[model samples]
Target: MFVAAEIKKNTYYDSVYLMRITKEIEKTEGVIDVLVGMGTELNKELVSSLSMMTKEIESLGPNDFFVVAKIKREEIMGVVTKKIDSLMNEKKKNNVKEHSPATLDSALKYNPEINFALISLPGEYAIEEAKKALEKNLHVMLFSDNISVEKEIELKLFAKQKGLLMMGPDCGTAIINGIPLAFANEVSRGNIGIISASGTGAQEVSVLIDKLGSGISQLIGTGGRDLKDEIGGITMIQAIEALEKDENTKIIVLISKPPSENVAEKIFKMLNNSKKNYVVNFIGSESKNVSNSKTHFAYSLEETAKMAVELANKSTVRNKEVDAKCKKAIEELKAKEKEAIASAKNMVGNLSVQRKYMRGLFTGGTLALEAMNILRGRGMEVYSNLAGDERFILSNANDSYRNACVDLGDDVFTRGRPHPMIEPSIRNERLIKEIRDEDVLVILMDCVLGYGSHENPAGEIANTLNLAKKDMTNEENDSPIIVVSIIGTNKDPQNLKESIIDLENAGAIVVFSTAQATRIVAEITKSIGEC
Candidate 1:
């Protein structure tokens, strides 16, 4: 392989754009991996992690734009570099073809009605850009992560006082005025509105709503940290107010991976005063359900969407077909789990191959939380970095406990790098390590698809899974079962049918719903019975 670096002095692009550019270029033929960004210590560290680092790259300053990649041949280097240039040119080509706005103020001059600005600058500059947008009377979606909690509270409070909504400092998904933004779906607009601190959490519920024959009215993303004690649920409360006053919304759904106790109480107080119907899916929270004729509690994302749709349509009776599917799913899991247990016990006592417990390496944080919750519900002591009892906290994200689920998208794992959704290389790098453990009976995962995610997510790890199986078979141990939940639709850029088939072809059990996959994992754990 060959490593190539391109240095363009005085050229600058925000980190988010660079992330997307790198992903697209990596798809080119003969390209192995890629790093595209301004040359800073963080970028250098990221490129180095992929073994493409060099003294020249390390010497680059923040002002210099760099394209670093590992290619199969020296000749492909030119093609890859040309592709990067073409991509940059394409990004610079705006629809209006006027002078590109140098400042937020100048952009506002071009179109005064721009009430929403999406900010993805570096964290240090995120606050200033957000303030500029707020001053211009525009609601903001801050996609940049790493902004301090203190700054978040300050900006959220300022936006609240001005009566404008601010989505996130690390917000990843939202839909407003019939348009999808930042890791969202293309579901039709209807009467159900969502307020979420979780990115993929909101995406899951909204997409499920679409599948349920109901659609979303709007989705307001409260950046993942909005519900912390520091932010005090500012965007969430603001969104609730906005949705309540909007004539289009008739039902409200709140999605999050649990909130602070004080904040949940504050939200519950707000919920009591609201007139619309409700379906609240607060994963991993011990909060009790409070339901009236209009309010309902949902324990899972699938249930949340179903309840919200039924409330929107005033349906009181559950469908017999749905009940039958549930019964069938439970039965099938039971039978398959029984067979798995027998196979494990009868495998010639190859103690070297006796698989024990489960390990989850998830790219989407919410899906990981969902899996963790389901496992815990099944009486399994599951440890996770993002959600769980403190005792179950992962000592180090890289280490696995009895039953461990690591959110690869967690801040620690993705620090100084792109999200797994943007670049699954890191997850792939780690999955190889996890699969080598014969004690791991099964590996559970989720493949999330939609706008602003990998174009072919399943394909990223599909071939590698086969490699894992081949190696395990060579070791004379049972190959770890790969159970996956694919969250996507036919309309996604990564064709859903192809993605599912890719996994299935690689000896994976691909489930359509995340909830089902989690239950299967729980069942397998129970059947395996602790090694």
Candidate 2:
């Protein structure tokens, strides 16, 4: 065990390049972990968290990029450290067509035909860069969080005036022209387009659409704040108009947590006049029957994707195969629920009154909300940090409430590190401590797999869970039940077949959709809770 560090002064690299380098170094023999990124305060904190910090790193600046690794031996550190530059050089060699732009202005000058810009700089700096992109007639996707709502509104207004899409100041996922962007999945190009205010909501729905043999024409993200009262759905309104006129899109899907009352009313009005068919899944709102024939209101992502497919295939004619796929998956889950509950009751002997609550530790915000809604629908009390009701907000994010679900990917949990989707270290440690509490009856989870997520998320999840359960049973308590909704497709870099097998082998109950997983969770807790 030794640590190696390097500081490249005045160098800039895209996050994608750094992540790839990190993954490659992690695969090297004797390397325990790796971190490669600019020497920003957050990146410095990331290395310091692992005790890999040094005087070199302490002196580094924001514009500098670094590669930090912890290895088994000082000698082996040299072997593994060189892989970063080696692999990155290979990347540069393969890219014969890409011209290195010195700055954003130079980037646009290199190619004036560029239609979009993606800004992931610090939040305070994002608004100015976004304005510059809009001035150049380029759409902007702001991937950084922490931008003020006022700034978000101002930038979005400027974009709307220019008739360009400003995706996010914290937007996580989007797919444009058949290309997957940050935190997105790859799907075939087809007639359906997605406009979402929720990142993981769009991800789950896109994967579901891909699984159903339908495909996506485009996915436009309206940064989560767009629908709030202050911003008022500016980007979404523009997207609806753009997609309505897009000949390639025959059907559209809008997915998000419920918007402000006024914004919701405005959206409904826009949907009413939409010339093309569309489905709406406003999760927090009531399911209403919109009088417009072409507009369908969906209460869940599965329904939204399925309904959009049905409408695109020709409204009123259902795809029996797709319906059967949904039916079959749920039926399988129901059967497993019965078998697992009976087995749990038998193994644990009797239910401890203390072990009667559900703790949802989710990386996907949308999945957490979906599960919360399901439990609420079934008359169960569930608290979520993401919920509008301040009462449900946890006083300490590290602590749990009566019935709690926490989005591990929220800014609170991600201040000094990458998102849980990319780094499961924090969540893994938390889950271990959670399972030790006798009060935790179930741990509902989401293992999201795709590009820009943890390379092999299930590997860490399965291994950590198995180790934690060992300690639980040694104390003569039953292992807490883990129900998972894996958001992925077979086309992902991490093989879907093998990943599911790993989870199954680790004694997890995996479901195809978040909705089914939530149903199973409610049933499990109810069966044990009543006893």
Candidate 3:
């Protein structure tokens, strides 16, 4: 193997753009892997981890732009470099033809009508940029992660004082006034408003609501850390207040991992005081009754969306009628579960005794957590990087233990690469690795489609899935059953129907909801006596 490095002193590009360039350059025939970024400490560590680090890379300052590639031949280095240069030139040409402002101040100056800023810089620089936007009386959505909790609290409080929405330090999804923003799906505009701390969690529910023949009014995102003890659900509380007064919102939905007990109490009090009916799904939380008549608790994202749709369609009816509708929704969900179990039984005929473990490679962290919770609830000893219980946490995230589910979108996997959402190909290697493992019985995943997500997520993995399955068959090992849940709508940039067709053609069992996919995997594991 050959490793090549190139440095451009003082040159800078946003991480997203760099990731895009990296993805494009990696398509070169001889390239095995690539990293493109500014020379930050984290980037240096990432290069080292990939064994692509060099003395030149070690000497680079943070301002220096670098591209490093591992390739099959030394001659391929020129091809990789030329590809990088071509991509950079293409971006520059596009920028020249468009009104691409380099900084927030310049952007606001060029267009004073801009009232919202989506900040996606490195964490060290994002806080200041977000504060500047908030000071300019603009709503802020901080897309960068690696931010400290203290910084998040500070930003949320300042935005609150300014009476502007501060969405996240790592917030990834939102739809405002019918426009989809980073990692969000397009749905009909209606009366259901959402405030979610989980990006893909929100996407799943919104897509499900659209599928159920209902729609959304607004979808607000509070970054995942907002509900912790220190931050105390600052952004969530503000979002709830906004939705409460929103005339178009007749039903509200809240999604998150279980909040701190104190934070949960505060959120419940606000929900109780609101006039609109609400459903709360703290994904993975035990479903329990709340004191408010208008409040409903859901155990899963599917149930949350269904209950919200029920309330939205029957908002004018009396409490008794609404109760009856919710009960019917629950009954319907139970019926679907029975069908899923039956389907799993039929599918398990292909499984061999060696096929006893389930491996989940998820791009969505929230979705990954939900899968782990569901599997554990079904009495499966699931290990994961996102596992909340120490005993269930995987010691090495890159290696799968018995019945392991990994969130590939976690920072560990995304340090110097695009999010699996942005570059669905990031999960390709991991997917193939799991496929080659003979002990794996089931492989579960999510295809999240939306405005800012990969154009054809399912297509991106289809070839890998095809090749891996063929290899397993050639080796005479039973290929693990691949189950995928697509979180998308027909209106998304990616054609939902085509995406589903591609996965099915690639031999994956395509489902619509993440919960349904998890349930199917659990049933298969149970049939094999592994759970």
Candidate 4:
């Protein structure tokens, strides 16, 4: 199907040689591939000259053709033909546009109303651009990580003073007037409003409500630091106050990983005093469920959404059964500690949990903080990621925490490898290894599903879990129990449901929200024993 020819003339440039080869091939029949080689009869210099010219000839067409210099004639022929075919196939796959950094920057000038600048540039250039956007009175949605929390707070304060919304220094998702923006889910709108300190927390809440055939009045992302000691819910408090004053909003949702007791108290006080209905989902903390009118306490995102939806419809909370069932689930978890530890990593949302007492690795900052919060709230001693310590410390864990209602877009995680949404194969081994020891019990994660998610995340999870099960069994132990808060649509991709079934079969109890998942696992682990 292909032919190789040796060109010996000194006048032959690769381009000319290719041209000659094509003409020759045209004269021949049944030849699909063409390769030109310079044999021993040709001088090395002439062969070298022909090499450059051959590319032009191939571009014109030979079915596929290649010319190589310096290498042996047969070797050159093989290399050229293979390269040509590969190049052709590559062209067919993705017509990637290669542009210099300057070209990309120039293109930015075209989008003016994009007042909210979301900078995901490397840290070196992000601050300067943020300053530029701020100077231009543009709202900023910062997706840049590695920027210091201090810088983030300063920028947020500056934006606030300027009467503009500055979403994040590591903000990955948001919603505007019920429309899913950035790394967000497609959900409709209603009277419910949200302010989240965790990037995906707001996304999960808003999207869940949206999927339930409702919508949001507003969803403001407070970055992850809004509830931290330094920030103290500055933006969140203001946003809640504003939403409370707005006539369109009937229900409000507060979603965060977890906050300090002092910060939590302030927020609780604010919500307790609000005239509008409010639902709170602090990922790992189980504060007193608000008993009076106008406010409700939800341990999970799904519960919060369910309550919000009910409030929108002027209905009261009628799910005492769900809470009781969740409590019973926690007891079942307590009975399965060793088995859970064998197959998965441990996670904590609160910071008061004794990291040293546990022998597992952690992944979510908020979840870790909540675990610590739970322990401290219950009058137990705990350690935190602060003090710049070597062990039990991480800065950006929430960035990777799985929230079913958010999509972090195809940015950092999707560039060159498999995204978390697509099944984290690379992340699985680490998860299994970290949890394989005798002290770990829980694998905490937020599972989000929607248009941009993997079709079979649950199925993929099950497969990974099955592999982990084999690993655990080989080590003479049972698989770890996985507690997941799954956020997505019953109407999402068909595989989403299948994935849930797969995860269930693989021994994961997948719930409806990260907050709920965290609460269930925490109560379950404490009851069962250290999972």
Candidate 5:
């Protein structure tokens, strides 16, 4: 075997593009492994771990682009380098054909009517660009994460003063003016408007609403930090005010992780005064009744969508009638829960006692949190990399503990690399490792589809899942149950039906919602405990 390294000083490409190139290069004959990325510390470490790092790579700075590969022979090094060059040329040709602008000024000059800026950059460099966009009176959706809380507050306050919507520094999903942006789905247009701090949470609800024959008016995302006490839900408050005044939006749905008490109270007070009906899902928060007759508190994303759809369908109804609809929705959810538990029992046949733990490898952080919360609610002590409680935090984000749901999209896993959502293959290695663990009874995952997410995400992981199942069969070990929840719609670019067929064909038990998938895992765990 031989190692080949190439460093291009001052050359840079989008992380997602680099990841795609890496995937394509890896398919070349005689190529053992490859890492293609900017020379960030994390990427260097990753190359070292793969035993492909060299002194030249070590000397490259963050601004430099590098490719390190382990190959079968020296001759294959030429083949690999040519592949990388061809891919880079292909991107350049596409860029030329598209006539893409290189800067905000040029973009505005190209189209003066633009009112929205979707910024995705490294956090260190994102704030200035965001500030520039806000200064231009543009609505900004900042996709970059890792920005300081202080910087976030500064940007939000500026946008608020200007009466502009500042969606996120880390926001990933939104559907504005009937167009899907960033990581969002294509659902029908209707009377329900969603404001969420959780990206995947919003996607789950939006898709579910569509599945229930309802649709979305708008889906606004307030980057995850907007609801923190320090931020005081600035973007969320602005979103609510905008929705309240929107004639098209009659039912408002809010989704987020439980917020700080003061922030929650602020939100509650606003909801109390709203003339339109609302559904609130402070995911994993204790169930509590709101003082307002028009408000419904939901415990899950599914419930949030159901209640919103119910209210939208019965907009003319008042207090008692609305309450009755919500009650019926909750009852329907309970029935589904019971059915999930029954299905879980039948699926856990002849399982060995040693296979006792549930392991979740997720690309969506919010989805991971929801699963952890469900498992914890059911008396399981779930550990996670995204855990708010230190007691449940994983000591090493790379390794899973007794009952773990890991958000592989977390910064620890994504630094200097493309997000798992953009490159689903990032989770493949971890899934294989988990499948080999004898203690893992069940594996839970999510396949998020839409613009800006990987195309055919389910197909990317199917081979890994299939090989694992085959190996388990050959060894006569009960294969760990694999549960996948797809958060998408039929209208998405990635055909939803085909994605499900790929997973099902690979021996995965595929569900439509994250809540149901986690509940199924929780039920399977409960059965194991009883045994």
Candidate 6:
């Protein structure tokens, strides 16, 4: 906010106290606060008067306010549009690549038992890739996004015709047999069969179930955005039918974000008629009437998985047993949520072990899915969608992914302009904001290190930490940032540990391996749950 007055030999050009007037500005609709920062000798008296007048005008009426200070509409609009254009470009860049095929021939030459082809290519190219895989008789876990309704229906139908299971086009996550695939959390093998519309929703819940010593029959992802307007629950409809018919599936679990009210009614009706014991989590959706044999409603992904595990292990619950079990777990969980919040706060400064939230900002579809299984065993959430956007996994802004690298054809991690791990400066603000909002509770992160690499990731993270520290308001619980730099001893920079320590000093918890860091989070989460 600036006010300028041209002085010509004391020939007073029409004078107004802009600053004083700004101060007198009234609280009006859509305005949160008004601040004035600049004033000069040429217009000191005028500025002072206007500042006072700003405070005065506020008292006049609801909308009345001193209006001497203003910026050119063109300038403001220009800056805003420029920002928007930059963001749009970033988004476009995120989805710019064509579909990539996996380098599976090499994989096959070495590992003949590799029975799975996790298809994560773009929708346009998915059918072709899937056709080739099905010809090879490989089971596919499709994790691609932007798949058309027609394509998905056709592919699923084709897969069925070939006696194969095609997991998803916009699949969130899935675990098959003993393997956690796609954006899935690690879980033990058991009898609960999960069919979910939300990816992270399914992964988190499934992992919870796994952590409880119970296992899964199969955890299936139906793809997020499946129940939208034109789509009309095609995947869910087919999925529920399939799960109901699956002989190995003793108990059925279904999870989704809030669906349209009308769609909810239809889905619930379908569930009501089903014979299997069920746990449902329509996150942010209403709890509807459940009738017939057995049905349970869970509010969150975590709770949904927990509910599924309990149901899976305990069979033929008597009325008395059901009543007692419900009462106990509900009370216990409420207490746990409180303690978890406290534990997260307490864990801030205690750097006994390195913990990380390893987000594989990967372009490689197969690698991302493979990584998910690896991370899942260690209890870290893996997130990436077919469209290359993981809101729950990555930042919301487009620019944050400007440097991200991926290959649609092969689904491999490729480097982009501003690589997220190397240029933490690009993402720290959003990461800090997410932490403040409690959207994440990560202490450290795992970053890949290979051929073409940034010179100093630890140093980059250190600088990012310094910038974040300057911006943070509530420094008490500034989340413990960490990074697990995955490098072989051969590629180790001479000062790797020292560089990591620099990040530690600037406010980061650095580590060496993704596995080790993930274990820490799992252990911590387990501890929190026990508390």
Cα distance off (Å), candidate 4, residue 385: 6.7
RMSD of 3: 3.2
lDDT of residue 326 for candidate 5: 54
Worst 10 residues of 1 by lDDT: 344-353
For all predicted structures, in order, the TM-scores are 0.83, 0.83, 0.92, 0.58, 0.90, 0.48
Ranking of candidates on lDDT, top first: 3, 5, 2, 1, 4, 6
lDDT tens string, model 5, 98-152?
Answer: 6688788898999999999998987877899999999988999999888999999
Highest-scoring model, TM-score: 3
Residue-wise lDDT of candidate 4 within 1-531, one digit each (tens)? Answer: 222443333422332234434334433334343335332222233434444334333333212323433332344455544554564466547656764244324535665555666676645468778877887788777766667877777787887788777777766667776545545665666678888877555656665575444568888787777788887777787788788898878888888866777788888888777788888887766766355577777765556777787677663354565345434544453444444433333333322233212211222334334434444444333334422223433334222221111122223233322345444443455456534543444555556565444455566566777776676444354434567656665545534567677777877866654444545555545553442
Worst 10 residues of 4 by lDDT: 398-407
Off by over 4 Å in 3: 1-3, 29-33, 48-59, 70-75, 287-289, 316-343, 473-477
Off by over 4 Å in 1: 1-6, 16-36, 44-61, 67-99, 289-293, 315-353, 469-477
lDDT of each: 0.80, 0.82, 0.87, 0.56, 0.87, 0.51
Give the per-residue lDDT digits (tens) of candidate 2, residues 445-481: 8999887798899988899888886776444556577
Residue 425 of model 2, lDDT score: 77
TM-score for candidate 5, residues paired by index? 0.90
Candidate 6: tens digits of C-alpha lDDT, residues 233-261: 66676677877898878788887766666
Model 2 residue runs over 4 Å out of place are 1-8, 13-61, 64-98, 287-289, 316-354, 469-477
Off by over 4 Å in 6: 1-115, 132-138, 160-163, 260-266, 316-337, 340-426, 432-531
lDDT of 6: 0.51
